[model samples]
Target: MTDERETVEYDSPTGGWGSLRGMVQTALRERPSAGAFETLRRQNKAGGFMCTSCAWGKPKHPHAFEFCENGAKATLWELTRYRCTPEFFAKHSVTELRGWSDHDLEHEGRLTHPMRYDAATDHYLPCEWEEAFAAIGTELKAIDPKSAIFYASGRASLETSYLYALFARLYGHNNLPDSSNMCHETTSVALTELIGSSVGTCVLGDFEHCDAIFFFGQNTGTNSPRFLHPLQKAVERGCKVVTFNPIREKGLIEFISPQNPAQMITGKGTEISCQYLQVRAGGDIAAIMGLCKFVFAEDERRGGTLIDRAFIADHCVGYEEFRAKADATTWDRIEQESGLSRADIEEAGRVYVAAERVIGVYGMGLTQHVHGFENIAMLINLLLMGGHIGREGAGICPVRGHSNVQGQRTVGISEKPELVPLDKLAEQFGFEPPRDTGTTTVDVCEGILDNTVQAFIGLGGNFLRAVPDQGRIEPAWERMRLTVQIATKLNRNHLFNGKTAYLLPCLGRSEEDMQAGGPQTVTIEDSFSHIHGSLGHRTPASEHLKSELAIVAGMAMATLPPNPKVHWKKWTGDYSLVRDLIAETYHEQFHDMNARMFEPGGFYRGNSARERVWKTKTGKAQFTAPEMLAATNVADADGRYRLVTVRSNDQFNTTIYGYSDRLRGIEGTRDVVLMNPQDIKRAGLSAGQRVTLVGDAGDDHVRRIGGLEIIPFDLPDGTIVGYYPELNPLIALHHHDQASKTPASKAVPVRIEA
Candidate 1:
């Protein structure tokens, strides 16, 4: 299998015929019909289902074709012709299907019925919805409330997530872990502590008027193609883009809009990055520190006129602490640590000085690290130094990875009681929520390992594969007494059977949601504050499949005491009631969720930062003092490479579209490590040589990923790149950001065994 696949350098820009070709092929294989294209036309449109791909917002004024290649694939994959019914499960046991890859499992098709694992045969047998809910209730009643963990995915809508929070708490457990803990946990931790809210301050419209954009640790071309449009427009208006990453991603360099007819005809792509700096893995803090030093030097040279003196005096705190940290750090230290020259760092500062309004964008590259929280605080320090936020076209933007992950958090999927205040919810729902703290994804994993968590119910995600140190975590996962997953398709997590397991199939986002109260439209929050109404019009894969909201409500109804304080059935059948309850719970922000959802492009969930109103502990936008990048996580041995897990253009999170990574110019394999030519030659290995990648995470567990082919590519020294989830095994379960508890998947120190 490794011998059949070969690497090829893609000469074309990101998103032209290559995007079109990939989109068409994926769609044809999944859902080959005229109806499929029609359904896609509504994707990200005025009143259509939001694509469960990346959470890049729909443009306030969208183009004719707003959907990207990956977005099309994401929705169409749900609308596939194939369906995995009861007969399909009866044919294969969990043991027999253990060898199948994640890609193959998903491609098998959408799940069509509820199933329970029969331990005798090691196979899953179909069960009634009532039976599944009863089973969950029986297990919950048997186990201690503290022993249960409820996990949520990013794609969960506001209504469903709100109910999930209520259900988990009412059933007497405070353990609520969500997908953000796996990806953008640092962003939330930094922003929530440093500023007030975890969500970004900027809106989607900021791209048009922003003078400059600094893309740190993000590849815009592939992860967020819809964002490229405004970025292209920004470039046309002379907006400079500066990128800091370990690899030269084609998207960050140049992007041709596949939706633009003129660009397609002319074959000319827009230049994306004015400057692209290849900083090493785990070097984000130092790189950001370099920018801060330059900004401070220029401020002194210009006699403080370069910074917003008035804004700083009026609305910020801790400027002195931030300045002191910057003053103590030297340029020589910055250069050595950031892997960039002093001149390049100053050049970045010069661009910042020239632009009046700046927009800073980042991704998991900055978040999933040992010092990830510090990395974000430093970026905010740079932004606050210039008084960039709290104004038009100026704020921090963290591109989210899923459809409604932001929305889910907004409606109370947080483990922190402060974010989802128990007092406020109790007043709204006539029930008091637990004031105690809950477990995060990392915490839940530890809980499972210690046997503290006996039951886990997932609300729409492949929980096992989405987490780190799966090799160690899976064994603990198997020890659980009861495990339940509410999903649209089959995933690896379903194979991990516990004493009792249930896979309850649910409706996808692109399917018709007709209920007792008539058709319903769900709302989702984007990377920005925009709320979009998603309406699905297609027929479901099976008559047995239920909506996520219904499934969640069913479980709540079965578990909670009879004649409960909250009416679960009334709200489940009528989504408006759920929206009404959400609005009541969060009256200040979502006072009229149902009414406002009907707006043409929906409305923005109010952002205080956007209005220059800080809501932090000090009631001001506080300037944070961040420490120097920690070298503690880096391996001590010489000639060791730091391996960062990355996503392929063809994939979305844990779902692998194919083996191809078109944006990075690789093809036909996920089990390949991208390495610097110098490092490759130093190890006495050439391109396509197979080697075992071993990791040292300061633990007793031996971490190794074997049989990975090496591909000599454009990566920084002492750094290598591998596909996400596949490389997740190398990351220790304990390895994570200290403050946020986010897995440090971006900075695993390793050596290649040839």
Candidate 2:
């Protein structure tokens, strides 16, 4: 008999263990012993850490080992055995490390000590913690704080986020650009316009009571595998789950519950969505418009309580204007714009009409466009028409990407909106906060390009890789006077040259944070308003590494003079003190944060909109009609396809854990772009042909990548999909959402050539 291991080609996409099923089988075949399982169980429950992969909601009663494949990889990465020591850095120069891929940099292991890049030696030399902190403090103090940017990552705990915001305000700058600005800025912008709040109105319990679910731009199966259970429960209860996305994901269509014993044993999966619609890329606004048009028309014809006339009259404003505009939209125009038949839209409207309680869930796909805000607003309008708000199982749900990103913004991580937050900063901290609006993520890059931003302190993030226009961003990063990164592991952002760049190794969430006194617990806010406590399981990987909260406090203490008015050092030792300060500074919702967090599944932040109590000036939900704009990209006579950048199942934003995209049948490669077979034939190109894609006009932005076999897909005419970071160079920096300054990553016009 042939040896199973010898017969398997582990490296090859097809010949080896490329398939997800095959990978799973191999993993089980070479399974670790019971001791390994026990260790994993202990580590998973340890106080301070949460899964770093997808922001899938945590189960109320989490299993001993409840993480997914990507989640496990992220956990192992954080709890890795390897270390990036001074000796390792001495052996490799900056030039040598710069040539490393994202995976290679991370695989080199966790950073063991604080290091500063030496231009002469082109190497990262170890620096003492005190010296590193002093250098960062000096650089920050030198810059006009308004021009200094403090960027946050999603992985940061609430304690760290609150401290970062406090430090930024204390330093006289409100230029707090965070990861949320890139992902969910549109959701915040839209929700505020419609309901006077920036958060989702639904909790996990709301899913149990929902009659119908309209999911858009998110693949719950891969992005948030934990959500599959709730979706499966909803499906079992006869709830209709509808999907609207550019790609038909398997997870959306069918979900195999890892926790379900019978289903797992039988190798059977639960059907997730009752209906799946493959909407065109950047066509969400059009699809939403079409749905509204159909609903309004149906309501008018049905008459007498068909529309929520009482709710519209009593609780909402601008319905007359919205109704008129929606009525004016023609069926033919809707079909032309959305690439969906009028019959299909009306059928979806029938689902909404039949259900008394409905919820709409969306992700970054709905937010990363020029008309993202409008797209979300339209969905809110749909929910309002059916009187879905303020009821159980009915509201707008924006599936946030980062675990704690929503909480970060909730605790005041923004460059705009100068209201109570600024006033509170002055009243509490005894410093007049900068009134002038500061730079956002896009604005920071623009400021860097214009030579205005002198210093950049990234609390935690891969800014260069995350931002658009890679060609311009690389040079702009190098131009900064000083760049400081507080990170646990090495990433591509560290390679971006600066006159003075320092990498300070910090403690991961999974590690214990024992300060001068004792063990510590950090806080995180879920997709809903509920805040929960987290404690670390394992000992600190290195004694030199500090908790994010301590690092922020240390930097603040080193930079600012002693102020008798405010007690900054007290917050460094205990997170509860910081929470108390937060309550005092922002008296809205967090007044009892300290007392409330002690309870299991902490209290809701109290969204007025969720209770049908609008906080807007008029005390009513308002609707605004946005003018429909023509397609930004016009096809050239040469028939170049419009290229759109998207994420794969195995990837999370800029972090590529692996190269296998199981849903799309893409394995071990990121070079191929999914294209319709009709487009390939029309362009006189065959499958597996190497092509060079170029932007319109004299923009020298071009990407030369090979083509894979053309699968006859359902993508709309004049559209193509490819992976981001690689394709970001082709998208112009100026093409962005005007309202929020988010890059129009969803829509970029391009021509493919052989």
Candidate 3:
């Protein structure tokens, strides 16, 4: 720990020697130094692996050092020398291991072989790959296909996810829920409805041309460091970057590129945000509404078409409806709900209007709310009003964290079967797939709780930690008839064993996957719609480890009765076959997928929104009057604070890199809650005082997470922040975006337990 007790620093920029040192320390600790360096150099480059940590698009012209700190961290972690062999598991019982932290569990090292939980021994014993697959197959085939859940984590490749999705469909189920359900599901839900696609309209080149970027509820620095490169360039080019979040993030403020040798030596950084707004948690809709009101009022004042009347008339719908809603939204209400003054919002509005090319960027902050879908709609509404869609430098950018969360959906990893191209699937696979909608993340969790869902097959991701209300979900998962996690590293999820649970070890993105057709390359879709190939730069962590693609294929072959139509062996042997299947399915977007994947930076999956062509029912980019659900609920409740779950700087999704959040000046702890000093005093508590957070959303289900030490933080008066997974218990499982079924993890009504 730093000598400075409870240290808090401000105005520090992200990246620098610190990031370099972090990368080195992690590498030395987890993997061989030489191998780690080679892997880092190879990240997101030609003939190297793409980072699975974030889906931030790559630069067209690469820098000397392409990868960022977290990307390096992810690389080192994936290529770790530490292995959890059978001997390791034999020493620790599930109960004993359950007491360990999520960090300690993963840090114990990667699973080296397929292991099945032996109830008699209370330990995971090594099992033969084929035997393990046979057991999993038996469980899947025995259970009702509708009751079985195939949970993808978005860490898998497009080919792997496609095969998994197909396997599930062939088995007659559409329960293809993924990590996107927790994060960018709201983005998908909004984009699909508004623009006829679920991906961002902008490409990486757009950043070079965009005049301004309005950052909504995302900490791009920590979550996506590669973004800082372009963001810094934008700042240097006099482009505006505005930010809105409860707590200010260093990445949004300034950045010193770790890759830049000059900056690394000089310790200088670049400023990013021209304007920063400390929006209250769940206030995105109000903030956008405020921005819209200014734009509308300005156009009215000008009377000579300041609101892009031509674009409005030709390219969009619901203008008058959205405009009236914007007008009806009072400045007082906006100020109160958004925690931003009318003048400040108008200043942002001015920036928005002045910029000819504007790009709106957002992440879970805008989408991880009860009104998350509405928040996205409002953001899109802001873009549509400015005629920002389908332009070279303008569009909505949904910054997905997982490498291929977007690709997973593109390859048919969706619960909504309506989105699936059933006619193509039937033509290609000869299976009349079930048209019925299956379980989503929410439904799967509900099913687990109610004991309706009996079996679970997780492709990747720490499912239990990532989900809300883990306290309830974990035990429910333990009660399942069968659970299989095809994973690289051990997580908290692995500890919660079902009656028959199996941990099937798989290859990481950095590891080589050699099948009958020799080494394989997988495809990942970036935040932009660019589809690229990633070739592993390192050898396999263990010979026993299988590709997620092969594992899914093995299970599919074993589970399904022998059929000529489903050529599982062929797909397993040659991944190109899987790519061929994708190309056959979505011929337009993935045409010549395997061939195009070999292109320098892969190919862009065609998004209709990018061409100003909306595939909507109304045949235009439809403006939406999103309900002010968050604003209506922003009324101050006595003894309550809007507690928002956030990630520490050292974390990636549920994977805690370490205990420190360097940017936040928080260290050596995960038990503290970030609160405004005024709110602490209002609650009759002092800084460093401990309190129990009692969830107060409603009903008989009272959630209490105790022993949280309050640390005074810079944020809105009514908003409090806590690092997630620990605070996951405070969020209700059912509390999610109604349209997207995404957990409302950002804001929850909570009070000090009295």
Point to the candidate with the largest lDDT.
3
Error of 3 at 740 (Å): 1.0
Clashing pairs in 3: none
* Residue lDDT tens for model 3, 206-251: 8889999999989887898889998888889989999998888899
Candidate order by decreasing lDDT: 3, 1, 2
Q: TM-score, each model?
A: 0.98, 0.92, 0.97
lDDT for 136 (candidate 1):
88
Q: Model 2 reaches what TM-score against the true structure? A: 0.92
541-575 per-residue lDDT for model 2 (tens digits): 68889888888888888888788776656777777
Residue pairs that clash (backbone atoms under 3 angstroms), model 1 = none
lDDT string for model 1 (1-754, tens) is 1221333356788888888999988977786434777788888877877888989978656778789888988877888898888898889989888799999999899898899999999989999999999988888888888889999988878888888988998888678889999989898888977778787898877887899999888877778878888888899899999999988888877778888888898878999899999988877788888888888888889897888878888988999888888889888878877888989888988899999999989999889988888888888888887889988889999999888888888888888888876887777667767888889999998988888989999998899998888888888888899999999889999999779999999888888898989988888888987888888888888899999999999998888886445888888779889888888888888888888885655688888877878878898888877766642266446857788898899888889888778887777788898887777777788788889998877668888989998887777788889988899989887778888899988878877899
| Model 1 stretches with alpha carbons more than 4 Å out | 1-8, 32-34, 630-632
> What lDDT score is found at residue 340 in candidate 3?
91
Candidate 2: list runs displaced more than 4 Å.
Answer: 1-48, 63-65, 417-420, 629-640, 697-714
